[model samples]
Target: MRKKRGIVKRRETGIKYEISRKNLHYEKALDEIIRIFETENYRDRTINDYRRNWREFFKIIGKENVFDVTREDFRKYIRQRMQMDGLAAGTVNIRLGGVKSIFSRLVKEGILTENPGKDIPKLRTDEKPIFAFSDRQLKRLFSIIDKTSVAGYRDYVAMITMLYCGLRANEIENLEISDIDFDNSVIMLPGSKNKNRKIRAVPMNRKVREELRQLIIENQENFGEDVTHVFLTTFGEPIHHGLIRKRMHKYGKDAGLIDEARVSPHSLRHTFAIRYLKNGGDIRTLQMILGHSDITTTQVYLRYNNDDIIEQYNKATENDDLNL
Candidate 1:
């Protein structure tokens, strides 16, 4: 009887130890999910977003034992996020995507048998049309910038680069003096947001060329030979996205352009695409210029009105012999 009682106690202790080990395994898996993004070389901004979303999730569910989380738990959490926090559908969906990614990683590593976040339906969001500055808006915006000042000159060149070349804000910030091809009147973008990651050359118009030339000359005068980047801040450091955004907003407000819609660095790129299409630039060429991997991605930049549609229809039917 004594031996049998000892045997039973040993079995209970073994089962408890196993359960504890399993719980730790689940917790470690959660940590690995966060670690995988960094190991995969995701962009810094993307990693930060993932970290924030995961932290929010862990706060609600607790950090340990993610394996026991159910699909219904995710639904409740999303509802709470929407109703309690007043997050928009798009914002909720972004957070949901991050959560789903974590589960997917765990499943791939065999830590979880299933991805609970996978089956949860994402919130619907209406796609807003891309906003671009009109010609009048552009003129007013430029007029507000103090062109004589050094900071103004740098901002002006940066604006022209994005407007003419359709470069992203980060791309503009990262540009170096070596990227400019003065002899060929082109700027070489060595890195882009495209998946293919191919180097692209953007041909500069006379106006763009002149502005870039002046920027280079001024940069050389101020920063000497070792400074590599084309754009710089007032303190001679490389330009950052935050400063660019602040300046753009200030100028927009001053010009009265901020009342209707927010003017951002991306608006210049959108303006470039709209103007390029209006001026007879083809979709395929615009795709290459914009560094888009797919022509469909470039099509979003083409905004058509009823007048534009009617004009095209009239032009096409002009060659027809139908008298009516």
Candidate 2:
């Protein structure tokens, strides 16, 4: 039995009627929002994120109806996430994005007349410098990797792929033998594997090509030609993200490089970007190679060091000497 909108449900007690205290619309609205997300082709992890955020919002809002939630309530929730939960603004924004989507969806569906989350402002984020490994640091890091063994070599190839090709962790994790174009000297990332969900071909350098080809051949010989994925564990199973991260972290530690820099998949990608720019590659080309949707992301590599600035300054003023 459903009560009309704006009419409170009541339970009879002899001659008296008491209004029901429960929120009537939360579950239904949540389900509808989830269905909408699915229809929109949102990834499973992303949909689950939205569900988690929505449930948390409901819990912290304290039995209030979804329709009655105010802008102040949203602000309070953000404050609690920041102060009590100790989340960074970037992380808070990622979670808040789900809630904001839900509010907008509700308003569009006529479930709400006005969206409280519409005017909710984004939090300011601090800019952090890109952490890229230096050439000496990379050589030091690579020296400790025991490439004589099968698994060791596989790990080596994986890291090399990231450093030279600039593949993201997820893309590398999902990489398959079919994705490699040996003759073309490029790695093809299907839309499913890429962050932007667009098919991208990343040209591989000579080192990447040789290493990847050797790894693929070794994988076929050891794990059987039926194995589809490019990288594999010693047990012949597909390599997972955690294993890759752990191995890279240990290598970073073994090389004593953790004190000054990060040694992870992202750092490898960053190192590739910095190295590419230093080698005189254009930013636009780097953007395409790295599969960045925004050119602005590639521009960050343009921020040069003091030594680079001085060298360029001296070169530009080469003919204008003060010697008399």
Tens digit of per-residue lDDT, candidate 1, span 181-207: 989999888754333568988888989
Q: What lDDT score belongs to each candidate, Candidate 1 first?
A: 0.78, 0.83
Extract clashing residue pairs from model 1: none
TM-score to native of every candidate shown:
0.83, 0.88
Give the alpha carbon lDDT tens digit for every residue of 193-286 in model 2: 8888899999998989999889989989998989999889888899876788899999999999989988888999988888888888999999
Clashing residue pairs, backbone N/CA/C < 3 A, model 2: none
Q: Identify the runs in model 1 with alpha carbons over 4 angstroms from their true place.
A: 1-21, 24-27, 192-197, 304-324
Which TM-score value belongs to model 2?
0.88
Tell me, by TM-score, which candidate is best.
2
- How many Å off is the CA of 324 in candidate 1? 20
